[model samples]
Target: MAMTAAPPRVVATEAALALIARLLARHGPLMFHQSGGCCDGSSPMCYARGELLLGEQDVYLGDIGGQPFHIGAAQYEYWKHTQIIIDAVPGRGGMFSLEGPEGMRFHSRSRLFDDAEWAALVAQQPACFQADQKL
Candidate 1:
């Protein structure tokens, strides 16, 4: 298989990581999950610490505001092309959002998964995830 790459060319500000550390410290544990949301149903999501790297996944588990936040291998792969970064703002605010190097903005939303993600999850753990009753 071809080697997957790292996330986009975006970097986080020191202030952001600092704020995240504070948030995680207060929340304890967290959960980063994904679900079908768009035409492809392909969304990348990560939250608390866990062992779920399925690819060249760059899983980062650290203190985000005192709580643990995780980014799996899947995200690392996609990050290579998106130029996405999680940063801090002037005030306490939302969990996480994506931004580009050109100063573009992409807000976080509910999970969006394509068929591939679902298949991968099912392949990895058949017992997990509910069957698509709509099918």
Candidate 2:
């Protein structure tokens, strides 16, 4: 049987949540994208909702601290076994992210999901696909 209480593949730290709340107050709704490309590498980039254009190749991983997070499908395949953890650090953010002006940047931290967690996530895949709620 499938797991009924699957954990999200992505989450945020308390500090990250606090920062996200502040950004929301100033920018309204927001979203994040972790691109496995050049320049920022795999850093999480924050944007006010609708500011960034998502391509067909993008995959929505899930929400973190209530903000939707996405990644390239190719990247998702590489990261599928890990849980993404968003955190805040004092620095300039991605040049275009909303937080760049706030002197705080969003960072990506990850760890491989434990065996049980991985199994539960895999079990939830069918439900996730049926939802078709990619943001």
Candidate 3:
């Protein structure tokens, strides 16, 4: 039997990708995390690569706009069955996120995965989750 590839846990809109490219050009490299912190109200937070530390308690949701995205394991538990849609909007994001001063913000929209999608995701092996990633 042939197994189908799981759908990405996270995806970004064209505008988000464009902003990411611009940020990358300015920042050299980047990463993203959403910890439901106070300032952003759960919005995706962008950071320069190595600016933040990733712990085993963080769940790697996957990449968005060619950069890795993650969330606290507790948050992941709440979001595990959903698909995260990343978008760029005009506003101030988290104070610490790289996008705060760019006149744009990275936002996260999510919807629960359908049964088929969930099944496919669950069928995948351990490779899907990144642990203890540096930078």
Q: What lDDT is obtained when candidate 1 is compared to the true structure?
A: 0.37
How do these models rank on TM-score, best leading?
A: 3, 2, 1
Candidate of highest lDDT = 2
Candidate 1, 25-90: lDDT as tens digits? 654444432312443133333334443333344444333334333445555344322333444444
Which of the predicted structures, 1 or 3, would earn the higher lDDT when compared with the native? 3
Q: How well does candidate 2 score on lDDT at residue 72?
A: 89
Name the weakest run of 10 consecutive residues (lDDT summed) in model 2.
126-135
Q: How many clashes show up in model 2? A: 0
- Name the better of 1 and 2 by lDDT: 2
Tens digits of per-residue lDDT, candidate 3, 39-125, equal 667888888998999999988888887899989988977788788999999988787888888899988899887766776787674
For each candidate, the alpha-carbon lDDT, in order, equals 0.37, 0.84, 0.84
